[model samples]
Target chain A: MSRREAPLNRVVMALSLVATATWLALPLASVAPNRIVPGTAHTATDLLGWPLALLACLPLVALMALSRRLDRVRCHLALALVLLLLMALPGWLAIASQWLVDPELPQARLGIGAAWWLSLFWLSLMLIELRSRLALVGWRAALLPVVVATAWWLQGAWLGSLALGQELDGRRGDFLEAVVDHLLLVGGAVGASLVLGALIALAMRQSPRVERLGFAVLNFLQTIPSLALFGLLLAPLAWLAARFDWLSAIGVSGIGWAPAFLALLGYSLLPMVRNTHVALSEVDPGVLEAARGMGMGRGQVFRQVRLPLALPVVIEGVRITTVQAIGLTAVAALIGAGGLGSFIFQGLGQAAMDLVLLGALPILAMALVADALLGALARRLDHRRLASPGGAP
Target chain B: MSGRQVNAWAAPLLWLSLLLLLALGGDWLEPLLRWSEPDARRVLYPQADLLTLLVRHVQVVAIASGLAVVIGVGAAILVTRPGGRDFLPLVAQFASMGQTFPPVAVLALAVPVLGFGTWPIIVALLLYGLLPIVRNTLAGLEGVDPAVQEAARGMGMGGAQRLWQVELPLAAPVILAGIRTSVTVNIATAALGATVGASNLGAPIIAGIVNNNTAYILQGALMIGLLALVVDSVFARLLPARQ
Candidate 1:
């Protein structure tokens, strides 16, 4: 390692630090009389008069400025500590918000400002950059969640500070319903898409012409903006529902979950079909010839030799489709499909950032979780394939 | 063009010509659609011409996707370099973050700060489009055969020479695939702009939804879907010919 490696995202870290400091020093949050009334803005010092906001940084800045010259493990550890501290800052802000609230103003609504968001963005940026260097493994990765949870737990002792929490608390039932609605929309679309997509793949495998047509159509369908696809489905769906009383009874209207489900299903088919096609076609010809030589009929060979080899890739397709569907389902809110997007659109309508976050955060979490879990599974399957003796069949 | 080339170009060409004709002759075509339903709303967004809307839509997509390609490809190159390798997962996560957030959410968040405009739409589209380009570029560049790279190195090529002459050319197809997916995806996503008050193909769809008129929606869907198909087909044409 003769070459000097550049520090990863140090520039981003510096900018983040600057932004966070500005967030703390400036009016950290705005306090409204209620959700409707805009209130006064106060920095932590102005509000709490104790600079508890700055206390979040003690873990970050405790190390001497000269610590940059320290050994690799030490410097890395310091950076990791900084990350852990930054994660706890939001919770500290929540605590400070509660601590600062006067008893007289019980209805005081705390709304997060741009500074708070910018600070969070930068902190995450710094964390992402620093995490790669930490070589976090085993219990190491668990440390972040534990610290972040601990911070939240400590802050929750006074519920007054958490604005977003209050927003959720006000409509806890609605929030949960929205969450369930989101899952249903995503679940319905993904389930329908998987079965339909597999059928399409199977049909495509019957002939080259089928494959070409299927791919081109699916690919083209994919290009149709989700909004447009929903639009296209609306007329036909409405007509079908109108023509058939049974369909209308089954909730097959032009809008809402029906069009949304159909549109999501349309968008999902390309990846699902493509993965399945690729997985199935990529099965070794030699293995197939051997299977046939071993007196395995077409059906038996397909069932025994082909399915196992293709299952992981098919699952990969499901993963991709599920993750994509999770995000796309948010758009279903536009047509009154009632998912997390309802909150997002409602937030937009009311210019409420918290409501938008309420919707957007969960979708983001769902996508990340799906991506990580599916990705790990895919990697595991690939590892098994690689580790097995000889080669892929 | 040769017979094979003409055959290759046929579908995209027809689609392209039809799109141009529709964009120019949308006013005339509105009457034809009305042949089936003369009473329904034929001209959904009477305020804006479909051509103007299509042009703006193209402009938004081209700009956003063009920028996405530059930033995505550049970031991919940077991270793949030995010095910047540590940042690869960060870049990947960031790009995927854009895709995972859902464009509507991004738009909803962006509108307050950015205000309503093509810029917010562009921001959403750009972020949404980044993943495929970055992901593909990384995969493509990494997929270059090490043996081929060694041979190039053995041939007395400098790092720059080897990369420009050998690696990039080899990776071009895969990178192109990523760009294709990104651009095509953005073409669809850019329609979200109508919600934020950017005049585009989505104007009619939003109008249709509001008015409960399917004709307007059909008109917009047709145009956008046609646009997506043509662009995707063009991308498919651009791929290096397989053996």
Candidate 2:
């Protein structure tokens, strides 16, 4: 490496260090009652382990920068080294912060801390080394989930201090005061969507008479805006209430979780139902025929052969639905469904960036986690199918 | 083969019948029977006719989708370049992130920066619409037979010319499918414009929610759903048969 290149390497590391430090310090400096990172809780930065994490980044960042100066393709190998260092930094910092800070102040659990740091380091390495071709068999497969999980976990740990556990009156942690309130709203909507979607798919598959109707219904549902669905549900909810006194109490204040959940479910039905049908149809015809030939009943063949073969694709559809649901659920907050969306909308109203992050971070975490978990499940199912009794049929 | 074809034709009709039964609840057979109260008409304003509401919705979706097509195609092209393949997945992943989040959140986030109404919704719709178009475009281009590409190159076609004349035409069917998906999703998502106070079909639905009016909700829902079906069917018919 040239002498000039060495100096530039130093500058990049210096810049990253400064950025990390400023990121750490600025939030601390502006400690407000309802800040994105609440002032009272212990963060990854507060642990004794945190400083080691910062120190750990130096070598990797240095290697990354210095390696860039070399034209030899072998320099790309430095990324593996840098990746290891990045992984080590966060845990070191988290541990250090834990050691140095007050024990009583809700610090991140060790598992969470390690996972959090490991992800950050890996993701950073990936981002920096994006231009290079660094392929590892199992590692590339493992890389994305680890990064997403750690990123989300850290966001949770940070927000946990700011919002989670703290008791705020009138307005809850930044969005609507009730976390469960939002969870139920979003959960019910999404859950109902799954059920309805499955039903629609099944119904459409079973009878051709209703296939077009199912398609039409799904197509229609996909077209109406989530906001419009919520609005549409409101009237039905209200009508049910007006007609029956007991129903009214439970149903339509038109501003609560019921309409929101129903609307989300309605919007979700399209992908779920349509994907289910397509996935089922895509099942290998030979496998299904064999199942039928084996004296398996129609129901048995469907449950064992068709569903198993279609499992991966169907789950993929669900994954799409869930991710879409998470976002749509946020809109539910507008009708009082109460998840992190409440914080975003509230922030918009109040013009508070902190509040927006406070809510948006959690929803984002929920999405990342849901996607990761579902992806893992999908992989497992894929493996099982590939390793079927017949062997890679 | 003939029996299977008959079954195939029969199966779709059977499914359609079942769904219609579920939707109408035997109202076809028992026309005299009234299972529920009659729904009221959707509130039609002097300024906002049905045609007007539809026109506005179409305009917003078209503009947003048009923008998305450009961005998606550009991103796909950029990522497919020799150097970009390594990082293309990451870019695609981030673009998917934009889709995964609620547009309402985007609308809310944009409200302060971009201010209220259709523009924020438009931006959000475009952002949300990017993933499918880009992903499909990349897949469609990649899926083109390499032999054809090689022959074109051998015939002295440059990269640009090959892409335009050969690959793009081959990819057009898949690309159109992607565009169709984006447009459909955008049309539905555009209804979210009502919250930030944009004028579209969401107008009646939002007003109905506020006023506890089922008629208004049904009107909008029914219309929007019908429109989606018609458009999807139309496009499905338009697509060329696979060879």
Candidate DockQ scores, in order: 0.49, 0.30
DockQ of model 1, rounded to 2 decimals: 0.49
Q: What is the two-chain DockQ of model 2? A: 0.30
Q: List the candidate 1 regions with Cα displacement exceeding 4 Å.
A: A1-28, A36-55, A61-83, A99-103, A122-154, A287-304, A384-393, B1-14, B35-38, B143-170, B233-243
Cα interface RMSD of each candidate = 2.4, 4.5
Worst 10 residues of 2 chain B by lDDT: B28-37
lDDT of 1 by residue, B1-243 (tens): 499989999889988888877677646777766653456745534634788899999999999999999999999998888777756888887887777666777777787568777888998888889999999999988999999999999999998898799989999998999998898878778888897789999988888777767677777877887888799889888984732
Residue-by-residue lDDT tens digits, candidate 2, B1-243? 898756545534554444333334432422222222244332332223444676787788889999999989888877776645644766576676677666766676566446667898899899889988988889888998999989998999987898899988988888889888888778777887876768876776666666655555555565565555555555665573733
- Candidate 2 per-residue C-alpha lDDT over A1-393 given as tens digits, one digit per residue, 9 for 90 to 100: 554432223222433455454434322211233333323333435532467545644554555465445333434545544455444444443443434344465532222232343345344545444333343324464674476457545644433332222323225544444556656665676677777777878888779978898778766566666766666566457667778887666655556776776677776777778778898888877877787777889888878777787888778878888877888778777667667777776775666554565566567667766776777688778888888653322
lDDT of 1 by residue, A120-166 (tens): 67666555555555555434654665676577567665555455777
TM per candidate comes to 0.85, 0.69
- Evaluate candidate 2 and give its CAPRI docking class based on DockQ: acceptable
lDDT of 1 at B32: 67
TM-score for chain B considered on its own, for each of the candidates: 0.92, 0.79
The worst-scoring run of ten residues by lDDT in candidate 1 chain B lies at B36-45
